[model samples]
Target: MGFLPITKEECEARGWSQPDFVLITGDGYIDHPSFGTAIISRLLENRGYKVAVLAQPDWNSKKDFMRFGRPRLGFLVNAGNVDSMVNHYSVFKHKRRTDAYSPGGEAGKRPNRAVIVYSNRAREAYKDVPIIIGGLEASLRRLGHYDYWDDKVRRSVLLDAKADILVYGMGERAVVEIAEALDSGIEAKDIGWIRGTCVKAREIYMDEDTVLLPSFESIVASKKAYAESFALQYKNNDFITAKRLVEQYAEGLYVVQNPPQPPLETLELDDVYGLPYEGTYHPSYEEAGGIPAIKEVEFSIISSRGCFGGCAFCALTYHQGRQVRGRSKESIVKEGRRLAALPGFKGYIHDVGGPTANFRGPACKKQLTRGGCTHKDCLYPAPCSQLEVDHKEYLEILRALRSIEGVKKVFIRSGVRFDYVMADKSDEFLRELCKYHVSGTLKVAPEHISDRVLSYMHKPNKRVFEEFSSKYKKINEQLGLKQYLIPYLISSHPGSTLKDAVELAEFLSDNGFVPDQVQDFYPTPGTLATCMYYTELDPLTMERVYVAKTMEEKKMQRALIHFNKPENRELVRAALVKTGREDLFGKLLRGSGRTQNPYKKEPPLRNQKEKTRSSGNRGGQPLKKSNKRRS
Candidate 1:
């Protein structure tokens, strides 16, 4: 069965009678956990509301309305995209041939009624419906935004998608409240007062109006200008420039995001705890008919919302906020016990993590009295000179989790913030983490190696990561554990030019790391990075630097991390030469002088049987019935 099994027939059958609500989903690709569509759909079903999902639907089609035929109450249209960046901005480059189909043969379309539309195309389709577009894609882009792929600044999705209201962040609580309001006979127009949502017309804009039309002639042109613009607005926390751009270019643009989503009760594992979880490296191996040798099978449960660490390039903090709300320890342990009882339980628990796994407490104790620490980071320039580090309660939770009966090894696989762990009052927690929780490698985010780049990204000094890595390694060795630290690094952030990338490459080479992976920075909307990309100035310092916007430049810097590898040497070497850096090309890349190409592979199989096997082995399309929503 797929994540949330609500079919068109089910809805049509239910629509013949009165039901409390109906959920309509625009799930592009399914199976990803980040999308809250599945959970919300299931939650409503659990609450006795007859719900049906329109998975990976063509929201623009009139026939797609059968999913919500003459519903008695409200219609929820959710563009299952996890973040507004993906929804407002386009990333169609990755679209495949099979991306156009909907599950169950498109039979679940909603019927035209005064039904609510939560999908992004509300304005273009079902225009008169009580449209409510809520999700990261609509929430973050609820105002005018710089569309990276389109190379133009566009109006808010609420305004553009023409949804009457835009909901942001986790929508469970807000949606439930909306259901109650609608059930009580309140008009959809009255929902503007709901927190964590934005509505047009009724929601007044008190923020300044500032709008600049991005050059739309070429993505390269917009990328070039946007890259420069992003560097300027990053970390400045000045809404003035953005507001000005909106007012000037998009006079009618406005957004209303009430308070952030209050943290929900930790998810009960009762439903998913007993399911067969296959933890394969590939995100969708099982649905593709491939069985992995090492499956880390367990449900990923989110314990909190938002991250306190205000990394400039990240849009999470901007939407989820720095404040964190945690699930009760009992709820977490209950889920653990349930999972331990699953049929596929192998005594190995895959992970228990969040945005930053270990940050389980409030940002600071002074939050209630002083309204939280306005400071961006606690360990950045110098360890928050006045802050207190507490890991006692947090560590207790971990220890209690390990004590669960059937759980053999409970791992913390989420990217853990090293600075936070190092600052804990005692190494006891670290020791416990090493002794019971870890499964060899710990994933951590250092992001970059250069001080300038780190500062521009609003990250802690490289020294902090170094210190944490050293301590973690020593502790592992002392415990006689055979494990390694797998560090995650990114390239081509707003201020990270080729020079910075080169320095990062050199650092990786010096440290004996072959640089196995690198994430090329993509401009995500509602992020400081997007502004920097457009403006090219340090959002705070008004500083400018060389911005790499070309595909060639991106490939060169991306390959720089893997230049030493034989397979990538030629492509990387050629890129270096193209940059007029032939000197470093030969030095860093092998086979540069010799014509022999070590990276070359054998010719394609011409044998009939081999070809047939290869063709048969191709990964099958994922189950389209999935209710999972991905941005």
Candidate 2:
């Protein structure tokens, strides 16, 4: 099939007066299943709807928004794969220099709060037509959320965007249901009861089955209320157990969010991936370096969706839900074969996993029917006895991909939950992973070494990571592979203090490694950690969390983590003195500019050998551009 029309001329060439749905996005058009725009548009087209794409439109005026000439059904808007503000700025609140989603890796292509901007402009162009917003930005801010950019709690994006409805989560099921509803002649405002949607209620809403959260006014007035509100929203994310949630705005008007749509089963997931995607950036971008985001995903196959590993800083729990879903091994193998045939295929499949690489299905059998428990996490503090830890299916898919012609190596760059690997009864997956999947280094995110800080991050304790590391090394030894472990760490998380930062620095030093990059906790919407960052309270426990909010502290945390770097000596000194650990100066820093860190003794493990980084790379390579927390 030909690509979806992106302009009026293309729409006419397809013999359509107007598109049934105009998939408006904030990123350059890449018809790859990895992109939400491609997935949703293809789903609509499969249902016989004429879908047009309006990607990275000119939001300063209504001209581009009107180019589709009033979508026959409605306008579906999103701020692309990543949130726009995050896409534009770094954790230090500095404007980012490049946008992988833009045409030429340029920044500032999309406005701040892109969902609100795009929706408003679409409304300006056609005030009467329905404007439905979804994707990361809209989905995260679907309720009264703490906006880090604004440093305040803002009402739902539906109210601010003047959108008819907001679709949250993995939106395939929700968008299609809404489209069918609209096709049957339901007005957008009247279409309030669809699952996975947030709509402004015309009348005050009260129902026995629906949950009521703290009002926007209440959350704004009190941080405790905000924490409580976030906690309530987090708990009701399960499709089987969740009730319709309503948040009060004014007395008469409310925002009603229906229970999330049920996650697609295997056959349905297969169909979505089986769509006729062109598997590359739209040709219109050829002159402008071709959406840099496509480079990371073009050779990748998304074998699954959703994550059961509930990390506090991640938004997956809020967006993708805890329930896991997977495409059949046949479906993924087909995609891998197609990737091999692509013009630039070089005998490498970049990735063959999803949110969590090893998770091919739900964490346990009960989750498929009963849903994930709201009270406890799947893998945090400790793994539940009932948690089903299996990697046999994921292994089969990888083995099949490796056997495909023209495929040399299948890498698991997306990441694996080290704790989950430890929980499993079998070591077969780890041994195979060490033998085949890992390139030269297996990248795992321990996030932090301090148990105190890790508790706040909802990550496994330092011991868990250490145990996993030891096992990985043993497996690599048996396979005679000289592989290493590149552990990803985060600093200045919600409960992190200067002491915690110092502990992490010492751990890195003792391990004979320093991170090439360190991630500071960024406060974005819709995560338990973000709520903790704003409210200074663990919304889950109502206990106060120590947060390092100032830029100075954030920098100090970074200085400590990379204390071996000569440039960070002063910052490290400052951090040591401030944390009342001046004695650490001698241990953390011992020499002049030539040999800044006098190398700690190494363990017998090969991973302990330190090699100089030429261009800020850890070991094998610099992180892929698409790398996020198991994203």
Candidate 3:
């Protein structure tokens, strides 16, 4: 019912000489379900296992790792809830000054590649004990992946960490199975048949039921091989149809990944959320200002897991898969009531949603038994005819939360899929969302306005966003609410040239919307966009794509999104001239007199052949210009 043991004193208080499992993490111990370490540790405890948390251990030596001594089962390691590379460095590869998951928001608490470092330390402390690694860092990098920080393809984290087993994805099922197997006298390396897990193999035996990806050497030597391997991994993610995958390394060494574990049913999901969580950071960290990451999730309730809205830049599909799973309405309402009773209970609940907020069930009935379509997306290109568009269950859950005692307001802070909302025939959810969930402004991601770029991102076209915007305005107007829409946009994505950047700038200008924050494309590991960025070819389609790789070009693209700002005028002008759109420079420089002439004369237009050659030399091959701007 209280916090888990983190030190030798706490372990003694529990009257245990050695814990059954020692969970070593790179984050401050926060007993919240939102934290992956908290979930796994608590799950083991509930099953009568003596679990001790060794959080943010001193990796320079084995001293801190020896605090818990040796565990009866094994040592479970994770790089906290986020990938450590993302937590330590910004998109520009600059070292971040602070870590929100650390106490006092301090940086350098955990070293680079925390999983590998901690695993090595654990091995040093007890040479023969089994070491297991999980969490986002290990999950996405279970196989050979492109490392953004290293700027090269690296071998599986399982091989590099020298850990016995690597559990990927939402790890509740996998963790329990591994624990049970280990308790039954099964060794770590021999227990390779479990789902959602990867292990190193010694032979090249092949099975007709399993899939063999490109070998590590081949993938490293050829970009095309890497793309093909990633495409196979992407398709075989669903639990229903996924096959065991094998990747070969040098000297006939291999890495074998089992199929993903099936998504939890409603009752199973309820049990995971119903664990006894302390719901706050460990008391020892109070003097260090506690964990800053808890502030965002303290009052929020996660209603669902997984996403069906496939975005190329997102890694959710590879991590959480495409199936949608939700907890019971009763479970959510109970959590909301418990949150209201917390010491600093406020009238507002920050958010009540997951990956995509409005999703309450699977996209269609067949997905429950057959899994998602491999070649097509549910909501991209266009909504499939079999897609079920209903938000009644989600709406009812929100209504129940609104009626809870001491609850004054409930906001949907997690993103809402506006395109999904538009697909519904009934407007009840939209009307009520505008009436209650609008906290003055609702945020949505219409990442870019160009059709060409949208295709590459696997996002809906500009017209879909325009239609959703119009519908949202009409509903807000009908309810007499002055709610504004704050759209999130991205810049310098693969297939986005200087011309596409200008098109997006014009869209923002015409709408009189200035984004407070703009996201430049970051090529993280295991995403389709990252593949395109690295190879200059779409993994799904082998066609060449233009990529803005240079710092100067990326800066110009980002500046164009905020062209109205006085500081960005020069960057915006330079972009327009470079793209052979100098005519738009006057429009961009109209208000700011920083340039010599507000209305610069336009140069003579180049011939079609000349324009083609000029644009091809800029980044990659030139894309066909489309005039389908949002009206």
Candidate 4:
């Protein structure tokens, strides 16, 4: 079973045998957010198509096709699964590496190894079947990228995965296009015209190449570049540059950017809610795994898609859109009931959230049929007036799900928009949120505490996060929930400097959320923040600003926020002195070590000779042409 599976009776009624498609995942881990495999599978099944999911298959054999025999439809290969996952490297970064070496868990297993494994099995078993690749791994790696570890350029994931077609963006609409075309006797080669897809062509025109440029791997070298390429710009629905990249590189790559899907109409919500669901988690849960956070939770559900915060480092807005599309309250409550029925199920449900769980409606209904939205937002910085600020519907759903039989406690455990909550200013909503959704702690991102950086990132000001935190604390205290806010902070975003980072560090120290995880900005392609990161711009004016890209500078800023701890104190002091900020070292060292962060001990140097050689070359000039030629 995949994250969401269709019932056998439904399959029988659809006049399908077994399934027309079988989806594959990597990492071997199943039970996760209804990601690429889950959503894609459900969509096809809803159309009376037969579908089956092989959550994580044994990588040992090509004969694995015998497991499913043959499907009348085709194959949907989602490397988005455990085995196919890559870390924060941009498409360009992926291309620069020697083969596919992902350092972040399940990656870096050896160059070109993941593709070889999936492709070899598909080629051997389902030679004639259409194999469509989609999801993060395939989407990001669809073009060449810079390989930070190996320091070289590489080919796109399509060339590597050898799948028939590569789907990009939020895949629902394009997926429907593919299915419709395939059902009508269209081949994979014809899928290029569909938006949000990348296909293969023998030749491409040079002048028109920008739209089809295979530079995805090349563009993501800097966090800022990635942010600018994908992250939202206020009021802007699409990240223009990211869309351009898709159009340019899409020529040769059968990639399509299907027009954005519309928000679920009111009348359509009931049918979605009426779909049969089984909450029993998939059996092959550990086929592949990474990111301990997913494993930590027992179960999870996507309550909605898309966000409106317009953070420069985030890509969700670009791909999923800012408009909120949600499953009906009945649907969610039904899923909750299923999970409770699972044997050995604890009383607690891990998570019930989405991109921004509290958000539950479209950006605007007028934009739906007009095709062109004049609102500054959905395109740039003004929030459209048509955007509603309502939590009533979402709150009702939450309460109903909690009432489901066997469900002990339900948690709202994904990204929460504190700014949105503060805007509603509803004490009833706040109190309900604190008492029902939280379990000890709630996670919220206030990417930075600096005024300039916050503006640059399109995030709400620190003042808002602070007010929300204070109010949330009050609510928790009144309810006796013992909850606290786990503020997620990002470092090294565009326009963020040592000075700004220091301010953020001081704020964190003063606010008493010490040693929390702080991310080193890794620019994802197709984000608005990437432009700022690459250019270091003013958030409001989009004017150029200063940025720090060096590793040492990044480490020092990271250490400052955790200076209260002994291990981080020395690191922060060393970093400060190195960056000419030694004056703050004394003040930073005043706090005593309180607790240890979860960190693995580094291994000793494998060879002294390698270390000596590296140290000797630290500041040395490059070898002369003659010397190089002689060698």
Each prediction's RMSD over C-alphas, in Å, is: 7.6, 5.1, 6.6, 9.9
Consecutive 10-residue window with the lowest summed lDDT within model 1: 622-631
- Per-residue alpha-carbon lDDT of candidate 2 for residues 435-492, written as tens digits (9 for 90 to 100): 8888888888898899999999888898998899889988888888898988777778
Report the C-alpha lDDT of model 4 over 413-513, residue by residue, as the tens digit. 66666777776746777788888877787778887888878767767677777888899988887887788877666666777888787777667767788
Deviation of model 2 at 513, angstroms? 2.5
TM-score of each: 0.76, 0.94, 0.94, 0.74
- Number of the top TM-score candidate: 2
CA lDDT scores, all candidates in order: 0.54, 0.85, 0.85, 0.56
| Model 3 pairs whose backbones collide | none
Model 2's C-alpha root-mean-square deviation from the true structure amounts to 5.1
Candidate 3, residue 57: Cα displacement in angstroms equals: 1.3
Clashes of each: 56, 0, 0, 84
- Candidates ranked, most accurate by TM-score first: 2, 3, 1, 4
Worst window of 10 by summed lDDT in candidate 2: 612-621
C-alpha RMSD between model 4 and the true structure: 9.9
